[model samples]
Target chain A: MYAFNYHKPATVAEAATLAGKHADGKLLAGGMTLLPTMKQRLASPSDIIDLSKLGDLRGIEVKDGVVTIKALTRHVTVANSAEVKKAIPALAELAGMIGDPAVRNRGTIGGSVANNDPAADYPAACLALGATIHTNKRSIPADDFFVGLFETALGEGEIITSISFPVPDKANYQKFRNPASRYAIVGVFVAKKGADVSVAVTGAGDSGVFRQKDFEAALKSNFSAAALDGKSQSAAGLNSDIHADAEYRAHLIGVMAKRAVAAAK
Target chain B: MPTVSMTVNGKPVTGEVDSRTLLVQFLRETLRMTGTHVGCDTSQCGCCVVHIDGDAVKSCTTLALSCEGAKVTTIEGLANGDQLHPMQEAFRENHGLQCGFCTPGMIMTAVELVGRKGHNLDEKTIREELEGNLCRCTGYHNIVKAIAAGAQAMGAKA
Candidate 1:
């Protein structure tokens, strides 16, 4: 732990200003990811700009067909919100199923999506539900938000204000949890809005979170598990580890997509 | 060294710690609240669980400086002198502990679970919720019982 400056700003403008001042400033959200990286000496910022004190950054509001969840909104908060549950129970269920009780209590929807952990659950929700990552600057579509494994479109000094998830007619997420980490070795989120079905897979891919166009196309034809009974995804870009192989992950993409469709039943 | 200040286990404390001092280290080494154990540094283990403004968080992965001006409740805050918190009581009553290493984290996690969603809770829900906070001792049998009982007790108390 090298010496560094710390600042807790009350407003987003002040926070952004502070971020701009420090050369190696890092926005401190829940620190589920940032703190550990710092501890491991993987990251060392010159200053830490704490966002927890920023009141304007926390809340969940559902208006019209849009579900806007503030960046600071905890997974527990989102999971328990009556409005969120009513508008999109699948999103609530996804939040409720993050890691465990401790992780969910502290981990924010913002932090989870920003970290862009390949094994995270929120990215699947973001991609499948066609959410918009609203930053202090502009809105980045979900398709463009996640750049790569452990990467996102977010830049230094740029803060994510909130995410806008479009309310879908039918949506569900099914994950095959890794035994040790409880992370999705393979998780799939299927969102159907009107006639379009978006299938996003997380946890079991080299590309972090991604859409299965083949699965989506098949499901759009007939939104059922039977649709995936004869189709599968390509294994070229999937992840392989002791937990699971690339081929298995590809297999899981098809299986979980089917299960997710059935779960949305 | 960075000057860190925060309220922990119902007490206001101040200490000059390193810039990278973890909340768990600050609690154990500086503040000496050893009840919150540090099992793993990778944020995987919940043994260092504590409530940062009533939210159960892995202390090992939390920076002490980041918790400035925030209220933190540790495992030691559960018992009121002699009476155990309902979750602790349930753990004791159900023989939910074996090694006792994971109890503090288990109680904290259970407290968080009820705090999050009490009405929407069931046995299956409880089992699904506690996947991250691992307890290698109990084989999760009695731990599940303890959490269920604690949830029931917490609901009754609520």
Candidate 2:
């Protein structure tokens, strides 16, 4: 990693101010992704504004029918949170399935969502569950949050404070993961609330996590695995890498979506 | 340069290090505690696993500055005087290692796993939980057995 100044801000206001002061500053949430990227010389920020000291941005709270996860809450906390499990077991399961136990211990939901890794699991859940991301400056819905691969709607010096997820009647996430890195090669999150259904696909789309309108419509009519029979996603505009071809990823999206629907509570 | 102070193996130590210094570097180089090996600096391999604030985390990925005032336990701290930790003993009795390169991390991860998953661990749970810790030698069959036996031994001791 390159030489850089690190600042541990005591509050969100201070952190944001420090971020604004440094033109080439990066907010260190969990540093799960940022650190690795820096180690490889992929990213070299002039300053790192560490948010670890921000005590207010580290918790999980459930109020009414919404689950609010603080920005700095580790993945392990979310996976083991009773409130999250009771309100949305699928979200808990998704959190548990990320990277591994050690990674879960350090990785944060805010970091994962902010980085907007296409192969990440949280984006799929956020998009499918219709989550709202609360930033220090303003709140952005999950639909408008993720813009592209490794990109989000967050502006310079903007820090995510928390994310609010509505409790779905039935929701589940299924992913075909890469065995080595455990990143999702193809992940599908299915969510149903009353008559509305949302299906989000990650690790497959070239433009990052996106909603499957066709699948959502099909499942809205019949909320079951059988409803997806013969329905297929187009291979176009999908990610094709050494791990999987675009066609294979498109096919896996359907397969995983069906499995998620079947397994969803 | 930044000054980082933390409790390592119950010892309060302070060091002047660069902001980019990793926790593993602080332990292995700064403090000369080489038990926490860095098999893979990319964080995929668990050779750098250690307990930071009683939670198992990859030392390679953790910044020393970030761990300010935290309690860190490495492989060297798992035993009492001359007696080895239960997990270490179980690994020895079960022949869990071949090259001994991944032993320290394997033991640390196992100890934390037992603390979280309880004393009774099945083969599948052990295998799944050992995802971050990679053992290229011994085919991991013996390691799995060692972890299971170690959990049981820990339960008995408790």
Candidate 3:
């Protein structure tokens, strides 16, 4: 890791202001990724702004059919929160089922989404569950938030305040985890809100979390496992790796989508 | 180098560390708490696991300077002189280790699990909770068994 100045902010505004002062400052949320990268000499910033002390950026709240998580809240906290479980059980279950007890306890949702790793689990929830990304600057729609692999609409030095997930009528997540990292090889999140259906696929896409129109269309017609008998997602525009080829992952997309639908119902 | 002060285990320890210093490095090199080993360097292995304010976290992935005024506990703090923590005792009796490379982290993780959910003991639940921790020893069978025993003992005491 490279030498840099460290500052812990008591408030979000102070953190953002400090971020703007430094040329190559990085936000330290959970350090699940940032610290590792620094160790590998992957990145050497001039300043490190630690966000853990910001009391406002932690907690779970449910109000008027929306589940809001402050950026600093860990996966385990969300997974165990009564309000989160009551409002979005699928989301809570997903949180409980992240990398493991260690990762779930330390890795923050904001850090995962902000980093926008192609294989992360939270992006699927954000995209499929119709979440709104609240930043220190503005709120971005889930679709508009993720720009590409490890990419997002967030500008340099921009701090994500919180994420608000709209409670859908039903939602579920299924992932083919990497044997080692346990990150998604291909994960899907399916949601239904009244007549509207949104299906987001993570892990298998190079362009980041994606909306599968075909599965949405199938589920709209009939929301059942039997309803997706011959449904298959195309291999085109998907990620291929040593664990699985795009063609194989594309098959998993359909299979997991079917299971996710069944689980949701 | 930046000077930082924090409570480690139960003692207030202060040191002058580089701004780039990792929390794992501080614990091992500065404080001589060598029990927290650095594994994989990519945060994959839970070898460097420790407690920061009662939350289990990978110390390798945290900056030492960032822990100012915070309370941290490592594997070294788990036992008193000649008395083993319940988790340690369970692992010993159950033969929970082979290479022992992952024991510190495994114990730390099991401690958190029992803290979160009492020792009910199920294979699937233990398997899921131990996911991020990769033990090449194939010693997971005994590790799970030990965790179950540890959970039972700890819960009974609580």
Candidate 4:
């Protein structure tokens, strides 16, 4: 890692000020992604504003059919959170499946969502559950929050404060992970609330995480894995890498979606 | 340069270090605690695993500044002086290691696993939980067996 100044702020306002002061300042949430990128010399910020000391950005609260997870809450916390498990077990399960125990101990949900890694698992749940991303400035719906691979709608110096997820009546997430890196080769999250249904696919989209409206519509009527029988999204515009081809990813999206639907309670 | 201070294995250590210095570097270089090895500088290998505030985290990926005032426990702190920790003994008795390169990290990870899940972990859970720690030497058969026994031994401790 290159030489850089590190600033630990006790408050959100202090963090914002520090971030604005430095020309190439980066906010360090969990540093799970940023640190590795820096170690490889892929990125070198002039200043790093550490948010781990900011107490305001850490907690889990569930109320009125919604679960609010603070941006700085670690992945391990979310996975072990009794409130999250009761309100949205699928979200907890997704959190548990990320990386491993060590990574989960340090990785944060906000960092994962903000980085918008195409292979990440949180964006699928955030989109499928119709969650809202609350920043220091304003709240953005999950659908509009993620722009593309390694991108989000967050403006300069806009720190994510928390994310609000509406507890679905039934939801489940399924992922086909790359054994080496443990990143999702293709993952699906399925959720149903009353007549509304959502099916989101991650790790397989060329434009990043996306929803399958057709599958959602079908599941809304039938509400079962059988509902998605003979259904498959187009292989076009999906990610193709050495690990998996676009066509195979597209096929796995359907397979994971069906499995998620079958697993959904 | 930045000053970093933390309680390592019960001793309060303070040092001046680079802002980008990793926790493993602080332990190995400044403090001369070489028990924590850096197997694969990338976070994938768990050779640098340590307890940061009682949780297993990769020291290589963690910044030294992030652990300010946090309690850290490394492989060297696992036992009493001259007496091996239960997990260490379990590894030896079970022939858990071949090269002994990944032993420190494996034991540290096992301690945290036992701390969280207790000694009654099932075989599938043990194999699944050890995903982060890679052992290329023993094929993981004896290591898994060692962890099971170590967990039981830790459970018997006060």
- Please write out the lDDT profile of model 3 over residues B1-158, one tens digit for every residue: 67989999899999999888888899999999899888776778888899888888888778888799999999989987789999999999999999888899989988988887777868888877787676889659999999999999887877
Candidate 1 per-residue C-alpha lDDT over A178-264 given as tens digits, one digit per residue, 9 for 90 to 100: 877778999999999999999999998797999999888988989888988889788898899999999999888888888899988
TM-score of every candidate: 0.91, 0.99, 0.96, 0.98
Candidate 1 segments whose C-alpha is farther than 4 A from its true place: A1-4, B114-125, B148-158
Query: How many clashes does the backbone of model 1 have?
Result: 0
Over 4 Å off in model 4, which ranges? none
Decide which is better by TM-score, 1 or 4: 4
DockQ for every prediction shown: 0.67, 0.89, 0.79, 0.91
Report, in order, each candidate's fnat. 0.88, 0.80, 0.90, 0.88
Sort by lDDT, top down from the best:
2, 4, 3, 1
| Higher-DockQ candidate of 1 and 3 | 3
| Chain A TM-scores, candidates in order | 0.95, 0.99, 0.96, 0.98
* Model 2 TM-score, all chains together: 0.99
Q: Give a tens-digit lDDT track for model 4, residues A146-214.
A: 999899999887889999999999999999999989999999999999899999999999989999999
Quote the positional error of residue A183 for candidate 4 in Å: 0.7
Question: B1-158, model 4: which lDDT tens digit per residue?
Answer: 78999999999999999999999999999999999999999888899999999999999999999999999999999889998999999999999999998888889889999988989877898899899999889999999999999888878885
Model 2: residues with Cα > 4 Å off, grouped in runs: none
Q: Which stretches of candidate 3 lie over 4 Å from their true place?
A: none
Interface RMSD of 1: 2.1
